[model samples]
Target: MNSSLLKNIKTLFKDTFSAEPVIIASPGRINIIGEHTDYNEGFVLPAAIDKGIIAAIGKSEGPDCTAIAIDLKESYRFSLKEVVPVKNGGWRNYVLGVVAEIRNCGKEPGNFSLVFGGDIPSGSGLSSSAALENSLVFGLNELFDLGLSRQEMILISQKAEHHFVGVKCGIMDQFASMFGQKDKALLLDCRDLSSEAFPIDFGDYEILLINSNVKHQLNDSAYNERRAVCEKVAAILNKEALRDVTHEDLLAIEDRISQANLQKCSYVIEENERVLKAVEAIRNNDIKTLGELLFASHHGMQHLYKITCEELDFLVEKARENPYVAGARMMGGGFGGCTINLVKKDKLESYKKLISESYKQQFRKECSFYHVHLSDGTHMIQTTE
Candidate 1:
């Protein structure tokens, strides 16, 4: 738990409840490498960023669950006994969904009033939703004395987002939010639910995120269409997921799958291998090799996965053109979001200025940029003062 966050929680609690409330934080993640691979049951390398969601929670008197977002300036209330889907852009669905999942898993759910906000850039491919869901679930567990382990908490959060939010995402985001460690990136095998933390020792190098400020509507059909294509290709190959296929395997049955589906399937298969190599490079302290992998991953995403847009590509390309930038790639569900880049620490300001000017000139849009570090996952911070 961060000390400053703990202090904020103490202040918020005294103001809201006339007592100190338990403060918990869950981190949003940036994938160092690996994209479009989680759904295919492949590997991903992601780290929890310093930016995250913080929740100050305490038990409510009534049977209803209530929450207020200090950042969004919104308040919501829901009944735990009769949890119904909320209408009117209910961001509360994420919280309600967690409660529902906890109950369905035979665990008693507790009602609470939560006040929360975060620095994690929403819709910037930084897994802000996962941070919210994880923080809520973790806060509830601590407040209610539930003995759910970290893994169970992750599963509960994943179910909440999938069933309530209606996004068919893989478990990487939730898992990363729960298990991340400072100075390390999680090399996760989504197929086996196992993970190993690799050292992020990019000396004198920093990870920078540039948000194009273009909204990525996950509810859009483009995401679903890509998922459907992957599923169709998997079914044709008689495999459970694209993870089961290799580059050679795809080539062997290339004629059976449509060209579009083949491209999607092949990218996942190859990307999985790249993730392993990236992990090895990190272990070996070979930042240059890992940087090259980032470039290859971007190429695969652009040409094969077909997720990167013009804005995203231009940002990545411009960033890569900088001598100080080792690698750059678009980071999320795509269509529009951020590109993560590895830039020399001393050259960061100049790099940011260059990209900002180039992006403005090319797209007539200003890019939002930020520096991030690997941080601890969800934990409680108690403070007095």
Candidate 2:
């Protein structure tokens, strides 16, 4: 939790709305492992990070609800009666989607004023959108006494992304953002929406993120294409999802599908297995094995999934060369984003300098670095008068 961001939101809300506000802190998330496997109903290991969005919201007197985006330096207004998604709505859609989904659930929430901003960098793969959606849904639940359970709130957040943002994202982001706990990573089963939290005790090591600061054009199209391939293969194998297909089952149909499609299916199956092993490794306090799995996961993502960009590959390779880094892999929907690394606390500065310089020289663009702490999920800070 950032005190400065909270202070800024309070000041912004008071100056704009002239009423007491209910404050919510909704955190962005980082997946420790299990990339590109959630839609397949495979396992994912994710934890909420300290970086997130803090929002101040209050019930207003009319049908029109006004919102101010403190970071974007913009304002928007909409009517509660007409809660349709706007074309190219950007952030507004997230707010509108939450309200729209609430109404869809047979609840009538009145108009409200809102002001929000966050420190989570866009396209850094920290799941800022999920954080924003959860913040609004959680805030509205509080203001209206919506009686929404945390699970219900996360589902609402997921639907908001699907219906309004036009992104067919899996439930991992919203689930992690809503259910995350401090010093723990969740081994989430996408099929059942159940998770086992593993306490992260990386004694002398820490979580580090190195952002490539580049989003390749292939990200969106490639994601859809890969997902379709997974679905197609699952249907061919007479399974509900790729999660149900074993390694031998994949091999049995290898002669039927293209080598490319085989690789994609193999990656999902293998990544799912790796996630299970990762949980056991955590349980036994085996950080080295965990780090090795990170490297292997990156190899599959790079070669089989083909979602990684040169910038991302370069960063992960650099991390591989450093003895201090236990494990590193490109996280989120690849093509460009951060590589999650576990580095020895002592070498944090030197590793950052080496990677930053090498990345800049190779790509001629500056990359960013973040040190993140595991944090709790979205919840109320206070209602200030």
Model 1 has an lDDT value of 0.84
- What TM-score does candidate 1 reach? 0.94
lDDT of candidate 1 over 260-285, digit per residue (tens)? 87888778888899999988888887
Q: What is the lDDT, from 0 to 100, of the residue 299 in candidate 1?
A: 92
Full-model lDDT for every candidate:
0.84, 0.90
Q: Model 1: residues >4 Å from true position, as ranges?
A: 1-10, 88-90
TM-score of each: 0.94, 0.96
Q: Cα deviation in Å at residue 81, candidate 2?
A: 2.5
**Which residue segments of model 2 deviate by more than 4 Å?**
216-219, 383-385
Which candidate number would show the highest lDDT if scored against the true structure? 2
| Clashes within 3 Å, all models in order | 0, 0
Residue 333 lDDT in candidate 2: 78
Error of 1 at 340 (Å): 0.9
